[model samples]
Target: MQKIISASNFADIMGVSKATLQKWETNGAFVPSIDPAGRKFFYVEKLLGVPEISDMVQSSWEEEMQVNPLRSYTSIELFAGAGGLALGLEKAGFSHILLNEIDHDACVTLQYNRPEWRVVEQDVRTISFKQFNGKVDFLSGGFPCQAFSYAGKQGGFNDTRGTLFFELARAVKEIQPKVFMGENVKGLAAHDGGRTLETIRNTIAELGYTLIEPRVLKAIFYQVPQKRERLILVAIRNDIADKVQFKWPDPYHRIMTLRDAFFKGELYDTDVPPSEGQTYPLKKQKVMELVPMGGYWRDLPLDVQKEYMGGSFELEGGKTGMARRLSLDEPSLTLTCAPAQKQTERCHPTETRPLTVREYARIQTFPDEWKFAGTLSSQYKQIGNAVPVNLAYAVGRSLIRLFNDIESL
Candidate 1:
């Protein structure tokens, strides 16, 4: 027989507050088992089919926009991954003329939800930008950062050949869009001792674009429920550079919590719907079951800790991710592709397992109805790689401000 966990215990296992659990239950985000004594309990089976609540929130935003519309602009996206950024832009009033993505599954996911979007599935290198030249108002991508070889000279555009950044620059050069935005892991700012980013700046300048001082945007500050960060780089074509002084979007007053993500509260009206999820093996599950809320391997008994940590027990730094459980009081740690991947485990606050697929999507601010394509692992990977939808919406709003200045000029 499966053991039942109380609502508080389950919330502890899932790393959420008891208040959050109660709110979710009240909102119909989740329905736990009720005993004859009127006590709320959660079963392992109940955890299996958590619904995608983020989609419901996003749909509400879409509905709100239809009633109180925003200014419209045209955009072309490169390296589009799973449509997170594109969808956020759409919500902010950007009409995408074309979206290019190399991954088959991601492209399929984009098309599956928004069939009206021009989903161009091809290697970005092979595509010509002549058609969009001088027409697109905005171009955007989350380009991968690669070090320039330098070749014993000042690194220039040619030295960046074979890297995805070059393709991004090539697109900007060809399209001459009024503005372009590029995003990457925050580490890109200091990559290659900052020389890589300097080269990118010079390259953009060579293409007659003025670069903004790149800044790392914190997702938590931008209404995302997780503590993820992305480095953003914006460039304005020389023709429009002086016309607008772009302002990054203001941070929301209240920070969103993991509870807000998975349950029905301030983030959504309806509770998360049931969906599929991954499970831990017997041995791992047994070990995780012993961990208390907000605890990790260090909290385990000494002998068990040594066995679970292996040689890592003697390592220097705190292996925080190892056996780590979340805390309900704070924002969740940055989510990864595999919730249960070794060395990066994201155990639930009160539960003995990793978060479900719907929970993962909610953390990334994906809308509930935005279905992912491919297998479970693929879905996780796609969500992990995406920009948080709300973060993208804030960025889109800022872009709109920038474009408005250009139009004024």
Candidate 2:
């Protein structure tokens, strides 16, 4: 299929400026057809044939292509927001013993989607995982990032008491799973100037688990069509860590885009199914209508720009996300809980509106049949808060491989 790429996206991909692209086209080096509206459309075949583009298209790191679990490995997840991580691991053949989530709507979403799975709808701190000790193969959590209290001691697990992470760390101590992983925003690696991570590292060691130096996994590098990043902290039981080696999941060969998320293409068998979505007010809609696909507020005319960005107009940083439109040919920006938020606008690529609930699900790589149960806002929050399913699947495969190695020995 032909992609009517925005000039900005094309220029960025081809390592040329808009002017340079125009010049190259005039010189007959490479040219794309221009629509009546003056937007450029390029053939995907020609785009991939470029030496620079070809390299990225050729390189692949999808772990499942090479690795498979030896058996039905079991897992339990805490703080399982919307089942993105759970579903991915399920796809990797991990039978979940239990999945815990706090939000009522999210719990319903999970229970509605997977009635057969155990859905614990309570706070993590109140639950005891002792029963599952040494039973589950993996334990995972996308614990919220909260600052630890540095009151009395050198911020160990105690300092993080009352925090959700403490609950995850508690589960690890109680369950003594073979491998435990905690995922959070990339900024966690440097949270509180790295002191927080030091505390987390020390806490994991104290719990008798050895942490593989935490690494941030970019969603776009996997099969996800968003630029979201997660800081993954995977630790192995001290007894087995020495006998096993953990490997990070590899990236997919080519990057996916909004096209893959919304249209019938490689990522989905059919186009996105219509679902509930938010709409902008008349005033906001008019302003957004001026934004070209892939362009942001800065692309608007100066007067409108000044009017639209009253306080932030004089700001130093680009503030590029304001009033932005997504690009069909590029991975979307990290989605926020509210798609229409002022600072982190996630506008649809072709339409001047927020992404639909299904579109948001699609971007996170949730399977088509998995339905979210809640108010529209709740659904968006669940999807936005999720770790992309494809990224989680990639990590799940790596965990399986590591477990396989441990079992072999």
Task: Give lDDT: candidate 2, residue 341.
Answer: 94
User: Among these predicted structures, which one has the highest lDDT?
Assistant: 2
The runs of at least 3 residues in candidate 2 whose Cα sits more than 4 Å from the true structure, single-residue gaps closed, are 1-63, 151-154
State every prediction's TM-score relative to the real structure. 0.83, 0.87
Tens-digit lDDT track for model 1 on 233-255? 99998877876798776655445
Residue 70 CA error for candidate 1 (Å)? 7.6
Clashes of each: 22, 1
Q: What residue runs in model 1 are displaced by over 4 Å at the alpha carbon?
A: 1-71
What number of backbone clashes does candidate 1 have, counting pairs of residues 3 or more apart or in separate chains? Answer: 22
